[model samples]
Target chain A: MHSESSPLGEFDLIQRFFKAGADAMRSNDQKMIALGIGDDCALLKPAAGEEIAITSDMLVAGRHFFMNANPELLGRKALAVNLSDLAAMGAKPIGFTLSIALPKVDAAWLEAFSKGLFAIANQYSCPLIGGDTTAGPLTISITAFGSIPSGKAIRRSGAKVGDDIWASGIVGDARLALAALRHEMNLPESDLKQIEHRMHNPTPRVELGMKIREVASAALDISDGLLGDLQHILNQSQVSAEVFLDRLPKSETLQKQSEDIQNQFAASGGDDYEICFTAPIDKRDAIDQISTALNLPLTRIGSVTKTAGVLEKLSLLNKNGVLLDETKSAALLKSFDHFVK
Target chain B: MHSESSPLGEFDLIQRFFKAGADAMRSNDQKMIALGIGDDCALLKPAAGEEIAITSDMLVAGRHFFMNANPELLGRKALAVNLSDLAAMGAKPIGFTLSIALPKVDAAWLEAFSKGLFAIANQYSCPLIGGDTTAGPLTISITAFGSIPSGKAIRRSGAKVGDDIWASGIVGDARLALAALRHEMNLPESDLKQIEHRMHNPTPRVELGMKIREVASAALDISDGLLGDLQHILNQSQVSAEVFLDRLPKSETLQKQSEDIQNQFAASGGDDYEICFTAPIDKRDAIDQISTALNLPLTRIGSVTKTAGVLEKLSLLNKNGVLLDETKSAALLKSFDHFVK
Candidate 1:
């Protein structure tokens, strides 16, 4: 299928590199895949009494990552971000498809990219089922599919007025990493190294999400920022919330920043692939126990209110438990909209 | 959700236009979609005893289409191409997710694009389940999911020796249309107008594909011309085939071209979203009847043979049923690979 006019056909290229990933997954005892690549469509049989959960995320060269970003880490992050979405839904790992546009056929870049992709895929038992590759501006779009019990899938619209808002793991480290990368903040070399992996290779809270499904009323993964993403839960649940600034968890490295820097970046910064959720006050003990069992931090930063609209009137409180000043509150309200750049 | 700095947030943008389309699909009494957008992941429940068939395709500007292509037609083509893959596998349309990277948020372009996208989605009963939209070079990647009876999907690896090869609808018209657009050859304005739709807005042969499932031993969609795509089936089935070039169906406009032009374009040109399949010789009468019932042009273009290891030795015959000359056959083997340019 290779020719001078056509260097390498799409199918041939895929077969040469990506097919091994699909084959590796098939070689495992995965019963869901009836067919993999090398076909018009890959056939998947969902587990009995399960509902498939689907999520897609796109990463562009200049927008999502640097043009010279490591292909290996980029590939891992591309699939990891989508996996984070599935984690927010408490869905078990199933399968995924990748649609990538490359500027050129760099065999070395592709080799490293697929290696990182399949590494994370096999780690989570989510196989690469199918994908399409083309020539264009470098962009990676990954769609991950998972499954949950038929009637037990977690949703964003199930929050109650009295539910306590919680977040999995530390937040703002990825944002801090970005700040160091952009030269917006002068961080020590050791601090930058500490959060670099948090920015490039996020750990999807799949296990924590699945453990909290029994208690959490509403859930979603934080990508844009904690404040902005929490607004989504508030909007979908038709309620308001009060987030305590001092209660927001941060890493030791992030804590080294000034008070104002810590507050703004932790509250409004982007790329925090952690789970933000809400659960009834009565289930707090259970959530805490699960968090301890999983060895991950699940901090309660706020509580849902009976307000009837979205997060329009959501309040941000100071360490003294008083509402923040109007100017600071307004800053927190202005989210990092990706299109706003 | 709307601000001066951000005209429309991603969530708000989706709610404004795309949500209505999702709501329309939900209002149709279809129970497959448990949840649509506005969540971390959309939940889908396939029909009982069905296997979900998944396929993804990416359309890039300047490569797959002209940069100034009509937004509406581009939207339709993006989804239709993926639907064509499901058709090749005899899968019933179910749902799709779109991951679009736009250079900017032009409301009018988005409106027209969504209108065209929903038009075909509704017509085929395939709802828009979920997707991700970001800022980048204009690129549309769609992952379509369909369902077929468990264990009944027509695969490309199923063809046996002595099977009759068939194709639904005319081939090479899309190629002819592309050639005209590229100005490689001269054509009448009427001829250009006649085949332009075939090139831009292709009709996936879903009904014909479903009907032929019982008869087709192997099947695939002709996206990269007849000879090249047929080679996919051959490679997968580990068999060879003899394609009668003269028997390849062509539109009236295409038939007016020279023999060399007709043969080359019909055999190797890409973008024909027609179904090319194979069935046992004994099923000819039944296939013919099914073709008549569906009112699709089902042409018998070749037959399968016992040859192992891909389509390396596949033969192409001329009008008089003789193998094509070496030069012509070599030309027919060169496909439209995007990397070549």
Candidate 2:
């Protein structure tokens, strides 16, 4: 993990970590990139009818990630995070440019890192097109491109009141991993492995995202805490939501944690890289079909309401089968409070 | 120009130096760029009938430019340098992404720097698409994108041995500016002003490059000095050139410098940002027309020869009709050599 002491110079680092990773992933049926990775520029031919989607993000040392994180995982996460942006917009991944600044080059670190990057890029069919490398503190900035049909992009502002709120896959595991990294709590090695995987290797739901475009009214990826991220949709769509605490999809590892910690992690912890989208209630059956076809879980956690406030609380019933006010129960999970900071 | 002491915080620095500049540029009509500079990612529509051209370059502090050079000029130069790469391949400027690592944010510096960036971007019609900002040592990396009609790009490998060599505008001013900055030579204020402008703001020959695509066999912009950069084209094309020192275009300011200094400046100083290209003899007349229409001076310095060496001097008869071995002419410039240790 101490890559700074490795023997690879910058040029070798580039040859090892960057050059091969991009070279092995050419899109099928798409006109292969004319020039990629090692040249002054990359050349790409557009498909006959589609448009390109481009996005960029910067990760700085000691700012974006922990200083001692595995370089291989870091490279993969960088590409994965950017890909999530494209997924959120319903675009198909195409190619990307990387701008890396390093204090010094380490050969072993670069080889592993580039291998990791290439592994994911190859899986997703995104080619490494062009980029720049320079000497400085560790910083990686990537601009990823994708393609989509014209006028079909799903934006954050499309959700409407009464739309059913849905999220794909599990949540809160990444946050738990971060806590584990900090050594705040002891957990079994098996659970630790799962949490670490969730933290370092997020799988952007690209297929589900593309399919959701046909059924969801609005969409965005959850990079920040779920509450804060969903708030973006609420603010943009002018709606509020009341998520049912009982309906949230939690990982088995998360369920094994204390209930209060799991609740806080679900509401406040970020980096899930999962799609949080909304659709009309009538499309629930269609969503179920999509979920089944993708073999991925999709949960209807709540409904968007015309009201302005977001509420989360446990439900209770008296012996007479009458619903009871659970004002204090809201404080138990602290769902709304988790995202305040 | 020590921007580290300026009052601006990081966020304001980004808004002033980056955002303001982006706001002034015109959008590319050929592609669908849904979200450009303001968002986390730029949403672009792939050009339906074109191929994308991408290039990137990094300018680092204490390596690329003077430590105290104006930050505004530095910002603009970052983008301009990358644009020069696109120009080398005859690509139409589209958009660019910037990854800037700064030691500290300085408001006034950012304002001037961003204004410089916007000025060039507006002139070239390339918009600021997307990028990232980080806190680190001063470094700027720009990844620029452009497009060309499919299979229409000009490349360095296309030059033939019998082609004529041509360069646009004048050279040597940028190198002279560097000398002046170092206080190695004393010149009049007017002369200093002219040379400094060349150093601070380089004009990438975009229009000239696009025009040359029709007539030139191969092309590249002059950044790493005319001799070294032209060698790239020669090496790639596997041709040798015999450039006539007398026919080289020089600025009045350069002509006023001491002969020894002028030779060194012209031979080794980089950052000219002029287009150096090769064309078959048959296209000379048509290229002259293009030069005239564009109001740009095209100097025919020499021709590509069957020989494999870069001969800076050619034996030729002087103005008095006396033959001289130009190889021994003290007027011939010697290349500058700088070693990094």
lDDT of 2 by residue, B1-341 (tens): 11222344444455676776676553445244666764335665556667788887777777677778887788678889888889888898888877777666556666776777777777777878777776766777777888777777888878887799998988889988877777877778888887787888887888887888889998888876776567667666877677765566789899987765665566547788888899999999999998899898999876787653443223333334454464533233222222111
lDDT of 2 by residue, A1-341 (tens): 01222344444456666776665564444454776764446787766666667777777777668888798899889999889988987888888888777666566777777877877788788878777776666778888887777666777778887888898898889989888877988888888997788898999788987898788888888776665577667766767666665566789899998867776687657889888899999999999999999999999877787753543222323334344356423332222211122
Per-prediction DockQ: 0.77, 0.28
User: What does DockQ come to for candidate 1?
Assistant: 0.77
lDDT of model number 2:
0.73
- Deviation in angstroms for A249 in model 1? 0.5
lDDT of 1 at A159: 87
Q: Report the lDDT tens digits of candidate 1 across residue range B39-104.
A: 999998877899999999999999899999998998788889999999999998889998988898
Interface RMSD of 2: 8.4
True contacts kept of each: 0.85, 0.45
Error of 1 at A118 (Å): 1.0
Return the top candidate by TM-score.
1
User: Relative to the unseen true structure, what is the C-alpha lDDT of residue A330 in candidate 2, on a scale of 0 to 100?
Assistant: 36
